[model samples]
Target chain A: MVTNEDAARLITAIKTSSTYDFTDYSDKSFCRRIEKILLDNNMDLNQLIHKIGKDKDFLEQMVKDITVNTTELFRNPEMWQTLRYHILPKFKKNRSIFIWHAGCSSGQEIYSMLILLNELGMFDQAKVFATDINTDMLEAAKAGQYKYRFNLGYLDNFDKVIKENPFNFEDKVDVPYEKYFDIDKVKDTIQMKPFLREKAVFRKHDLVKDGNVFYSKFDLIFCRNVIIYFNNKLQSRVIDMFNSSLNRDGYLILGSHESILGASANNFERSKGFYKKKQM
Target chain B: MNDYKAIMIGGSAGSFQVVSRIIAALPANYPLPILMCLHRLKHIRSGFVEALSIKSKLPIIEPHDKEPLKAGRIYLAPANYHMYIELGNRFSLSTEDVVNHSRPSIDLSFFSASYNFKKKLVGIILSGANKDGALGLKSVTDNGGLTIVQDPKECQVPTMTTASMNATKVDYVFSTKQIIDFLLKLA
Candidate 1:
C-alpha cells in the first residue's frame, strides 16, 4: 500500500528536520510501520509528514515506535548461558570491562548483565552503558523500579545460569528476591536497591541516526533481538558500527533468531552466542 | 483440508484462556500441525507448551529454527521470534522486527500461512487485545484459505476476534470450545 512517492516524501521530511535517518532501513518494513503510525494517529501520509515536520515530540515517538524495541531480561536463556560460561570469563583478565547494552529497553537486560557480573564477582570491575532511543524507557531504567513479579523470572534465570556454570562455578551467590528489592508498603512497589543501581549508566542513543556516543571501545556489547526489524542494508550498517565500537577480541551478542550472515559474518567469529571481534 | 496440512493460531493479551480451551478440545488423533503465535513478553520463560501439553492429547513443543513440520504435533512460537511455515514442510524463524508491535506476531504467521499454504491453510483469530489478526485473516480468505474466528461475545478480550469478524467473511465464528470441537471434527 506504500507507494514510492510516499516513501520518498517521508524520507525527505525526516532527513531535513529530524536528528535520525531511517532512509537506509528496509522499504517494506519502514512503509509498514509508517502506515501503522498513520493509522494509529488517524492521519494519511501527507498529514503524518506535516505533523512530523512540525512536531519534535511527535517525531521522537514515531522513531521509537518504528525501531522495534520489544526486549526482555535474559531473553533466550541459551544466549545468556553462553555469555556467562564462555564470554565473561575471558573478560575477567581485563583491568576493567566496558559493556554497552545497546537498544536496551527498560534496562531489564542490563540489570540481568549486572546480576551476572555481581555473581561472577566482576561487578566492581565492570561498567555498563545502557542506551536506547526511548528517553522514557531510559528514565525508567535510571529509576530502577520494577514490579516484583517481573524480577522473579530474571532472578530465577540468573540463579539457574550461575549455579549451573561448569567453570569457576559457585553455589554461594544467593540473590534472593528480598536482597535486591525493598518492599514498599505504601504503594505496593518493589524498588531496586542502591547496589544494583550503581553499575549502569543510562543514556538515549539512536542507532540509526545518532553517531556513536562512545569515545573509546567496549569489551562486550549486547544488541539482542533488535536488528530483525531493519532491512538487510540497515542490519549490515549496524553490524559495522558494532564491529567498529568493539576493541580487539570484544564480544557482540545478538538475538537467538538473528545471525551475522552475508557481509557482517566475515568481520567476526562466532564465539558461542557472541561474535568475537577478529583482526580487520 | 486440501493444501493446509496444518493450522497456525496467533493471539495476544487476552489469548491464554482461549488458546488453552481450544487446544484442550482437540481430539487425540488430530492430523494437522497446530502452530501457535501467541505474544509473550520476551523475558518471561513461556510455560505455554507445558500449559497446553497436559490439556491436549497432542504433543506440544517449542519449535526450533528449521525444525521440519510434522503432522499431529503442536508447535508454539518461542518468545521473541516470528515463526513462519515454509513450502516444503520446514519452519523458518525471524527476529526481523515486530509486526503490529509483536515479534511472535499473529499477522506475520497468518500472512505467511496464507502465502505458503494458500487454500490448504486454516487461519484462526482468537481473543486478543489488538487488531493483529484481522488483516491476516482477510489475507488467508482471499488466498482461498479457510478462516475461523472466535465469537466476540465469548472472548475474554473481544477486540481482536471482533476485528477479524468485521474485517473478513470468515468461514465460521464460534465459541472457543466449539471452535476446538470443529477443529477436531476437521482433523
Candidate 2:
C-alpha cells in the first residue's frame, strides 16, 4: 500500500525532474499509476526516487503510460457521420476554417478529420491544430504514419459510415482510405500521404493548464476521450476551457460515452450529440 | 448482511441476459448499491444500461467519475473504461490499458471495492468466456468479503466460474434460479 507521503514525494520528484505537473489529476488514479510504475520496475519507492533523476527515460515513460490510452482511427463512427453530414458542411463556405484536435494522441482523430475534409472538398480551407501533452505521441503524430492494419471494428465503422452516407447518396462521394495510405511491408505501417500531413501543426500542450490552447478561437474543437481520468473539478475547468476556446456557434465534439450534463455549459447548445458554443 | 453496503458482480460474454434477470429479481429499493463490471464492445456506444433497465426494478446508471455511489442503485462500468471506487465511496474511472484482455475487467473493480469496502461487499462471478473475474473474487475473500460464483452447469459459458473456483474458495455456488432466489431473499 502506497502512503500519501510516498505519493507526494513521487509527485514532487516528478515535477522537479520534468515539465509535467499532474497535481490536478485525481489522487487515487495518480497514486495507482505510481504503484504500477513501481511494480513494473520491481523497485520500491526509494529506488523509484533514485531513478527519477538518473534514468532520463524513466519519468517520460511513466507519464506516457499514465496519459496515453488507446485511440483508434474513425472511432465511434456515428459521431463522425454526424459531424460529416450536419456540422462540418456548414464550414465549407467559411473562409479559412481553424480546427483544433485537442489531445490528438497518435493523430488518428486528426487524420480522420482530414480525411473527412478531403472527401468534403474542404481540406485546403482548413488549418488544423493538433496537440497532446505526451512528447512521444506528438512526435508520432508529426510523422503522420500509423499501423497498416486497423481493428476489424474500425473497418466495420468505415463501411457503416459509407453505407449510411445519406448526405451524398446521389453524388456518391466515397471515402478512399487506401488513397491516403500505402503499405510499408517491412515496417508494418501505413504512411499517411504527404499532402494531408501539410495541413496540420502539432504541439505539446496540457489540457489542465491555461494558455495552452493553440488558438483563441476555433471553428471546431475535437477533445474526445481525454477527460475521464480527471475529477469533477478538473473536468469543469477543462470544459470551461473548451467553451472559451470555441468561436461563436463553433462545435465541441466529445467522445460518444462522455455525458455533458454535469457541467454548467450554459453557453453550449446540443446539436446531434455535438455541443455548439452559443454566441453569449 | 444488512451491514453490507455494496454488491459487485462481474462477467464477460453471455452475462448480459443473466445480469438483467438478476436485476429483475431484486426490488426497486434494494438497500445495497450494486457495482458491475462486464466486458463489452469498445468500438460502439452501448445501450446496455437502458437495455438492462427495461427489466430491472431499480435504476441502472453508467456512473461518471467522482460521482457518489448511492444505495439502491445499479452502477455499471461504461464501455471501454476501467471502473474503480475511490477510498471514500466516490467512483473513479481509468482509461489505462485493458487488463486480462478486457477493459472494465472484473478484477480491477473487485480489487478496488474490496480494498475500500472490505467485508461490506458481496463479490460475485458469473457467466464469462475469459478468466477475468477469478483474481478479483480472491481479493474480496482476502478482504473478508463474501464471495459467490454461478455454478458452471447453469452458466452459458463456464470458464469464468471454473476459474473463480480454481483461484479461491468461493462461499456459495448457485445456478441462475438459485441466484435469483438468493437476491430475492436479500431483498
List pairs with backbone clashes in candidate 1: A228-B96, A229-B96, B3-B120, B4-B120
Over A24-118, each residue of candidate 1 has an lDDT whose tens digit, in order, gives 65444566678778888988988988888899988888877776555555666677777777778988988899999888877778877877787
List model 2 lDDT by residue over B1-187, tens digit each: 4578789999888888889889888887788888999988775456777788899888888887677889899999988778889877988777777789998778989988998899988998999999999999999999999999998988899999999999999999998788878766765
Q: What is the C-alpha lDDT of each candidate?
A: 0.76, 0.81
A1-280 per-residue lDDT for model 2 (tens digits):
5754687788788888887777667766677778787898899999988887788687778888778457877877878888888888888899878899888988878887887788778988898898888888988887877765654455566565644575666655456667776667677677789887777998888887755456358888888877766767777888888887777878888875564646556778877779888876
State the TM-score for model 2.
0.91
The parts of candidate 1 lying over 4 Å away from their true place are A1-8, A26-32, A149-152, A162-173, A185-188, B1-77, B82-103, B111-135, B142-167, B170-187
Q: How accurate is candidate 1 locally (lDDT)?
A: 0.76
